[model samples]
Target: MARQHPEEPTLVELTIEEVKAMGKQGIDHPSTRPVITGGVVGAIAGAVLPVVTWPVGLFAGAAIALYTRVKR
Candidate 1:
């Protein structure tokens, strides 16, 4: 079995810390840009698609981006 690094944080811990940082820092947080980019891309996709609304697409995109960022 592979041993985990003592200094490395677990996924849950990293996610919690990232969430806290986002809440405290708002747009200034490091994860902001990727999230915003994802939102924009989603918005554009939504606009292009007749079934989905821009607002919903924007939210979904941002959430996906945030998840990816946290995992990283």
Candidate 2:
């Protein structure tokens, strides 16, 4: 690897902490569903739901996974 700069990374080399902070910056946290996961699920659900409108299929699967909670 090349020498890391005294200055921060220009476009690349963003640290995980920086990335996470950037990801959730200025937003309420402890979210029930992660933004990324929720986004992916929503995308899949929206794409697939129209073709196969089954009662227990892709859209429902994603919805259940995102929404269901187990009781203690």
TM-scores, all candidates, are 0.70, 0.27
Best by TM-score: 1
| 1-72 per-residue lDDT for model 1 (tens digits) | 999867888888887888798889998999988889999999988889999999989988988898899876
Q: Which residues of candidate 2, in runs, are more than 4 Å off?
A: 1-33, 51-72
Write out the backbone clash pairs for model 2.
none
The residue pairs that clash in candidate 1, if any, are: none
Give one digit per residue, the lDDT tens place, for model 2 in 8-43.
Answer: 553323333434663676345332344435545656
**Model 1, which residues run further than 4 Å from truth?**
1-16
Give lDDT for model 2: 0.46
Give the range where candidate 2 is weakest over 10 consecutive residues by summed lDDT. 63-72
Q: What is the lDDT of residue 67 in candidate 2?
A: 39
Which 10-residue span in candidate 1 carries the lowest summed lDDT?
4-13
